[model samples]
Target: MNATVVYELAGSYFGGTSSRPVPAKLVVADDRLRVIAGDDLLAGPLPLAEIVVSSRLGNTPRMLRFADGASFETAGNATVDRLLAGQGRRHGLVHRLESSLRYVLVGLLVTIAFVWGGVRYGIPALAEATAFALPEAASRQIGEGVLELLDDDLLFPSELTAEEQARLRQRFVPMIAASGLPIRLEFRKAARELGANAFALPSGTVVFTDQLVKLAEHDEELLGVLAHEIGHIDRRHGLRQVLQSSALGLLTMTVTGDVSSVSSLIAAIPAILTQLGYSRDFEYEADDFAAELMANHRIDAAQLGTMLMRLEDALRKCPEVERCADPERGWTTYLSTHPPTTERLQRLTKR
Candidate 1:
């Protein structure tokens, strides 16, 4: 005959239908289990494997469930551990992890590293991949109505004469053709509201404010600006900026299985692009592209630097009466969207 090992625990028993529990004792002997109340046998003397045991969670009560829908709840966690040990059963995996300070610190460090890596590298890389994978028609759709929205709210009809506009277009013909993308140039007047600015839309439309055109001393400077905007289109930087800005929202929607909100996000893209502008890295990339384009055309890249410095001076000297209508938007001037003039000048002048 096998040696008998017995253990008992005090707890409460629920008959599976009642809100009230009765005082009960759980008896474990030689791999068999039973629940009793004083003189009454409330539940089975069944095999230990037939009873389900809840994992230990801090000092909370653990529950043992039986096949007949009755359960015994107890706070005798140590005794339950011993009972399980005697039966050669594994238990308290969560409790073992939680009780160790070293494990807690390691978990915290791992969480921090994961969050940092996602924000720093993972999100941007995913945004870039998504931007590139999207079709040209989708890019055009994103940019559609954007210029009209800006025209209705911020920009005005170009005041430059037809002759002058045609002349600039004639000069831009070679550069635009060289780009090998469907590129179009537009001129707008935002003298009082935007001062002098140039921006690119995702659909390969590049807008040059009339103030910017008049501010340039040489055609090379204007071409340089055009090259920069082309860079934005070729690399889909505008779309990438929109994607990166809305990453958290996209992630939340994906996690919750609610992609219906994506349309609302897409609708907000025009506002986000105009208001937030491109990131510093995007600006640097475009500047490098412009410098290389100018070199290929044998135009001095330093002319871009000259134009940038002049634009800065002109914006600063805006007559009090004609100052930008929304100074906070900073979308009013090229300098506002582009990087610091000194940093750009250093790179452009070197080439």
Candidate 2:
């Protein structure tokens, strides 16, 4: 049943077909019906007419009265279904877009979880394994690097009088021995260059800056500082940090025999040092251990606290003395990397 379609909306009757009734829903979609007939599939030329028409089925019929007294009926149910299918397709597209966004959000959450878990647990285990597998040659290279860095500032050449030097040995040696670590202490007299910094090497070597000795108001201060550095060795903090930072480099070189990336990372060593503040918990643990060492040896923990207080005060007053020795801007290095002074003091005083 092929037919031409015509439209009549209001008082205008458009040329249309009677063979196929134009769908009411399509007509509603576009009301430009002066040319469209109810049966017009091909939107070709059709003469428009003036008419008032109405529908037959529903009470609200599409009514249009033609000038020539003719009329066209409204479209049937099948055309309404076609309009509904078009709407469904649009809704389906929106659903797919929403689904894609959900997947992206889920992927980001998974990535975050994996990274957080890896850092909290996997890194330490990986470092422990790497430490066992590390070769002597590699260890020596690391040791040499540490020694080179410390050599520039370690040892006080001429500042301590002979009696003062002997007294430093007596105070430090017994205290270190009391701490129960298999570590040795050596003093040097390069007083001019290495005044205020101390370090521990990977190969069990501890270097004390001559300036650090000079800054100490008493032996407890020096002992406190040295014990903290020894704690780093005992807990393997230094080894773990180094392994974690170099994990990618080590793994890449191990698998691919590439060294450039590792070398580049090594070259940025100073920047790494500047940023290597210990975790707060690690600092507190070290302080607690040092306090225990002092208590075990019958040395007063308050003396250590007093030493810190004096150092803090002296820093406030004669900043230039420490500043001239070390290039550090202030106590940011000690304060940020260590526990709060008040908290450490409280712990020392606790029964």
Candidate 3:
């Protein structure tokens, strides 16, 4: 056998392992490997059946291990290249990916594009479909968890009278009944924080903050807000948001074959509630929903536009530093990606 590659060889000794590298020569021929040092034989004239190779991923030095616990580590340019050409091991996906500079560049671009598509379109689409497909029991559990978190961190006791609550909920009775889903309504005081806002829970619960109710100049405006929130519930935006937020973690788990990572995402549902940051398109969809619903009910859709404009003004009045009080940390506030209020108003004008 011709001399192959030199490696710094070290292995476990007694209670601890040596960190030193000894110069040696390795050769492979006739389906056998041999190692030689100055005046000694180390590992070889052994059949290839005893050798175990390491993956070529990352920058870690490639290692060749023998059944007898003998091993060699090298930068792997010579040995791996030679062994790969010899055809003992199959080329791995990662190896193929690392085969050339062009592959690396092209793979990187494709990877970026793939991940961006997943995050931007694929994850959300899957979540949207899955949200509606999910059993009612799951959404109920998720909604309960979210409400508990809000109670602990953001919501205060409602100050509105029972009559006001009942009256406000009355308007949505037909819509809720038509949807055939168990939609519940709740109210809470905003505690001079979070200002005026309404959001939908995964279980078809629509919550109205006291400030939000007070902010409305008329029943029509409140109806507009309710319609908007119902739009979110109808689209399962809360659940979709949760799924989207956990997409990367889920992908990592899938790639690494770690199935348990899903448990963390499930357990973190409440945490995701405060992060229900809808995309701009989601906001537009919700706005369109509110408009169409209003128009179908013979109610002026412009009231929603007016209401959004008023809410925008109110949100702008609230100082930036003060927005930290919301459990969502003003995520649904001005910091949100909801389409500009002007856009909604423009659409209403066209209507």
lDDT leader: 1
The per-model lDDT (C-alpha) reads: 0.81, 0.54, 0.71
lDDT of 2 by residue, 195-259 (tens): 35556665556666556677777777788777766776566556656776676445434544634
Collision pairs in model 1: none
Clashes of each: 0, 34, 0
Q: Candidate 1: which stretches are off by over 4 Å?
A: 1-46, 50-94, 191-193, 251-278, 318-338
Relative to the true structure, candidate 3 reaches a TM of 0.70
Q: 136-220 in candidate 3: lDDT tens per residue?
A: 6777777877876888878998999999888888877875676556778889986555668888898778889999888888988
- Candidate 3 wrong stretches, greater than 4 Å: 1-32, 35-60, 63-76, 79-99, 250-278, 319-335, 348-351
Give the lDDT ranking, best first. Answer: 1, 3, 2
lDDT of 1 at 211: 90
lDDT of 1 by residue, 38-130 (tens): 999988788888888998878999999888788999999999988878769886678778788998899889986885577557777887899
As for TM-score, the candidate ahead, 1 or 2, is 1
Give lDDT: candidate 3, residue 221.
Answer: 86
Q: What is the lDDT of residue 305 in candidate 3?
A: 82
